[model samples]
Target: MPNNSLNYHNCKCNIDVMHLQSQDIPLVARLYKRSFQNHFLGHMGHKFLTLFISEFVNSDANSGYVAKYRNEVIGFVLATTSDNPFREFYRDNFMTLVYLTISRFFKDSFIRSHITKRLGHVHVALKALFSFSVRVRDSREKQEICLSRQPRLLALAVDRSYRGLGVANELTAEFCREMKELGFKKVGLSALPWNQRAISFYIKDGWEKEEASETSISFSRLL
Candidate 1:
């Protein structure tokens, strides 16, 4: 069985944070879909959002957390401890996300018939092959793929209504403290660079960006 009943609460907000139960799957799915859709709605579409959330929720490699106010889900984080769920389709998702981004380039009529479509297939195939090869190599190189025995912070969101109330900070800080107490050297996150608020918050909270591209920034902190 999973850790279905951990008492996760925001000390600053004084609200209970629920460990996601399987029964909460639908609600979790809804919140996740809504939260991400709201952020990337124009960039993608309902189909993409739905697909990603479903993968996050149903995957064995992943687990989820949610923050609620008055029993209504206000925030969520979806995470994978190791590589299980992704080992299967990691490359698929990566290629899909990339394709979704560069698809406009395929509009060139000259290449659409031969180079473009073929390139997309090749990209996906190469991604999958690379993913599989890496996992096998990693497995052979290491005795164990040691993951954080402590809970890791995954995707975290504060509903707009709860955004400015410090709930996000409180939840993240608490998770960070938990990781430190569990002897983790640091915590990791990837924030979209466009989300200045999130970047600012992490920086203020002592996290630093390792790399920033036009799209995303990787963040980490020593516990």
Candidate 2:
């Protein structure tokens, strides 16, 4: 368990949460990659974070929050809209969107060509067509899997050095307050089931689990 005695006023730590700018993207991603290294070791790599820094940092500036102390970023909260919250964001983030589309196109093209060349006679045209339809439906389903009512708090991490301090609570509370002000009725976050400490923290702060999957538990708070 984390130390419970640390308080913002008496800790002599300067905690300030603010919106991160484009220049801060690299530092933020670096900090996040370091803080979450252990948790995401087998799941993702540093280059993925580095390459997607722009998409993560620029996803939803108003909903993203970062905590700094002594001029260094100590923690961050990254979020994305449920389903293209604003049409304008689609255009603004067109570069990343296009990148995703192009990658998908090439990936599908390569897979189709490989299958056609290798199993040309084994798999009939009807079977290949059925397989292609299944793949398309699965891809679309994955893309549409979003919270219906609340925006997701996709990632949140605190530097190990600052964990015990009330920074996490402060950042989370600020996120909830901001979402409430923006007319959202609730906010959601997910964590691995093994992280009992995080689960307890969320429950202590009034977040209740609305869903549970094999690897994660989704928590939400009514705003």
Candidate 3:
């Protein structure tokens, strides 16, 4: 059941924020696919997208939250509280990853566009692995300040119809409150450079830009 219900901007309707559960994966996957229609994960197909969201929920149920309106899930936030999230994710879901790779390689589209994107994922994973290793070798100071004990907001999406009703704000505020109770000094998140709406939302919510690059911008806030 949802933890509690909240009014959206003094509206008559209420939104419920709760811990994400296994049963909500399908609905969340569909919402994610719709929210990020042009993104790579959306293009990975519904089955793969479901599996992707499942990993986050399975990894740390306490760190994930869902927003429901009228008993229907309308948005979700998936995050990792582990210090080494990538390594932990690979370790926990290695078998699934292998199966998906093999199946996609053989049964998926053989067209150049699809094949290229699939290969691109492999290249990106390898590069990220190498980058992680290097960061581990370097001092903690050199690593992204946001990668500490604080939880990282990995993915967040809301149904288009519910975008401006303060669902995102409530979800984030609740997560930060939980993190503070767990003794975290700060919480962090990142967004693509082009996601100006997300960036503005974070800024207005008291998060400060901690780092930036051509590809992404990282933000953190004291909890």
Candidate 4:
């Protein structure tokens, strides 16, 4: 069962922070799209986003939480004590995702370009075998698959209308508490290098900067 604990009065109405239920996926996915509008994942559309977010909720390695006011989900956070969330998502949904990607590729020019770029990165041999007009998936999965049990905050999102009212703070605090209570020694997360707000937020919350690359900056906090 999901945790139905924690409530905040930072706003006039009580904001309840609890474990995410199955019914909350659509709302959370909507929030994710709104929160990451300029990102590649956001362009995947609602149905894809629905199935993507549902993987986090359904996986035993993942934990999800939501903040609500008057029973409306206004924010959500997803974490994992292991790295199997994405692996499992693609494993179970590959064919379906490929169909969706093919449909989107023909309909959306941006998706077509993105898939084209992905195709460019494939090996010459693999490309020959998969020589199709357009590639179906945008991401190339690594051939070597190894699972890790490191606790990491996967994603956090809040409704635009509900920001700055302590909703994000409560969600982060609760997520950390849940990880600690589960015997995790530490947890980490990464934000895109250009997302200054997210980098600042993690730093403000006492997550020490760990490492960085062209794409992302990593932060960690000891439990």
Against the true structure, what is each candidate's TM-score?
0.59, 0.63, 0.74, 0.78
Estimate, for each residue in 118-190, the C-alpha lDDT of model 1 and write its tens digit.
Answer: 4555555455657644443654343234433323456777765566666666667666665565456777788
Candidate that would win on TM-score:
4
Residue 53 of model 3, lDDT score: 75
Candidate ranking under TM-score, highest first, comes to 4, 3, 2, 1
C-alpha lDDT values of all predictions: 0.57, 0.62, 0.72, 0.73
Task: Tell me the spans in candidate 4 whose CA falls farther than 4 Å from its real position.
Answer: 1-9, 116-148
lDDT (Cα, tens digit) per residue for candidate 4, span 37-108: 766667778888898888766565778999888788888888887553465566566667777777877777
Which segments of candidate 1 are over 4 A away from where they belong?
1-13, 38-61, 83-85, 88-144, 147-154, 181-183
| Tens-digit lDDT string for candidate 2 (9-96) | 7544557887766766777778876776444321233443544455555554325678877567778887755543323333344455
How big is the positional error of residue 98 in model 4, measured in Å on the Cα after superposition? 0.5
Tell me the lDDT of model 4 at 188.
88
TM-score, cand. 3? 0.74
Backbone clash total, candidate 4: 0
Error of 1 at 97 (Å): 13
**Every candidate's CA RMSD:** 8.3, 10.7, 6.3, 8.6
